[model samples]
Target: MPENDVIAAGARTVIRLPRPADQAEFLARVRDSAALHHPWLAPPATPADFRAYLERLTEPQTEGFLVCERESGALAGFVNINAIVRRAFLSGALGYAAFVPYAGRGHMSEGIGLVVRHAFTDLGLHRLEINVQPGNTASIALAKRAGFRLEGFSPDYLFIAGAWRDHERWALTAEMTADGPGAGR
Candidate 1:
């Protein structure tokens, strides 16, 4: 994605690429949202950590996007597409977090829909997947609302919070929707 590229636009929010300058405000929000994110996520809360986060996303296999409220241009959350594979599978995994102030406000749902659309159309990928901890109901809800279907459950899908956690795999494909490229919109 290009710098500041507007990936998608919704009534309440816009999804765009994260910029280096967003470190200060993004870290501040992450710090303030520590409680809200505990046990569910652990986004970068310091300048150095945030920089490292950005660096990882700078790799060819990863992409980071920020969901910002259109009215104030304040970040509501972020979605990252990781492990992109292009040759045959044409798929990627998704990870995201909704900030404290924006949690439960439907920003993530809208943002995720946008990201799904971008993944299928702009990125030319066939499928996008999200792996959510079984206990994270909010994340699962967002994935379902955005049209991802529950595939299966894995015993030790990911190592999070210093332990191997079970995860529910959810996925969506461009071919699954009748509306084709405009389905997510």
Candidate 2:
């Protein structure tokens, strides 16, 4: 995406919507990172799948972003705000993944920070949540580093890989960050 299309940008990365032009690179990255994503989440793996996934993001309640490296314009990973609820709740759930080439490089951490700011400021969301399977240490760490507090645990929160998986619920309200009500941006 062009800089103008970036929804958010950190020092090392930028977040933008996945476009049709990105299908090849995005799919290649996903294919290379399959080992890294196994048993946790499944991203778009085919052209048809990408088209379907992009179509889903057009819904009013869902937003998806691709975290890209600023220097090389490569796909770092993806972050999505899913199941957004308006009215009284004004919240959304976050889902993210770091591709093999970019894992452990801190790009995702910065991307998430940008996402948090965008969620609170641009999207007018009051809360953002992340659910992680118990064994996914990397995901849990990323959420923690992004300032999402562990709220509780769900015995069978989601179905992943096959059966129902237990997940730890982590959340961050707008008030928890610098952009809290009455605070200066």
Candidate 3:
């Protein structure tokens, strides 16, 4: 795949997987957002750790992308389609977050919409799930905007911010894409 052609939603941004050359830039972004993201994302741990994390996500079994500003090429955020399960069920979980500076700009919603289309139409995934803490209104809103239905809540589902938090489960199916819900603009 072309490094620049991974996905685009024509919303002043693009989504594509990170390359090794991006390590220094990506590390800087992670460091800058340490406080805002530590509650959910591991706090970088180390430069090597960040590289390893990115390398793992680039594997065939996982699909991950960085949200970049079209004009400036700034690293705004990231999204991941992980833990793919192919068997009786073809599914994966979606996780995403924008740097504090990029929040509230609607970039995440647009990036997610593009990735969802790729997951269903290009990757042929059947289902996508998102787990968000009860208090994360922004994430919950993004999920809804991307046409994921609130399936239910899972108590103590994940250890976030040093505590186990209840998560609201949201999901979208490939069928929903054909119907226009998960279709990108």
RMSD each, Å? 2.8, 1.2, 3.1
For 72-146, candidate 3 gives per-residue lDDT tens digits of: 777788889988887767799998878768877977887888888788777878899999987778788889899
The better-scoring model by TM-score among 1 and 3 is 1
TM-score of each: 0.92, 0.97, 0.86
Worst lDDT run of 10 residues, candidate 3, spans 1-10
How are the candidates ranked when ordered by TM-score, highest leading?
A: 2, 1, 3
lDDT by residue for model 2 (12-71), tens:
999998898999999999999999999899888999999998999999999999999988
Alpha carbon lDDT at 119, candidate 2: 91
Q: Which stretches of candidate 2 lie over 4 Å from their true place?
A: none
User: What lDDT tens digits, residue by residue, belong to model 1 across residues 1-185?
Assistant: 33356778999989988878899889888887888777876788778888899899889889889998877889999999999999899999999999879999999898988888788778888888999998898899898898899999999888876788899999998887543566657
Reference-based lDDT, each prediction: 0.87, 0.93, 0.80
RMSD of 2: 1.2
How does candidate 3 score on lDDT? 0.80
Model 2, CA-based lDDT: 0.93
115: Cα error in model 3, Å:
0.7
Highest lDDT model number:
2
Q: How far out, in Å, is residue 72 in model 1? A: 0.6
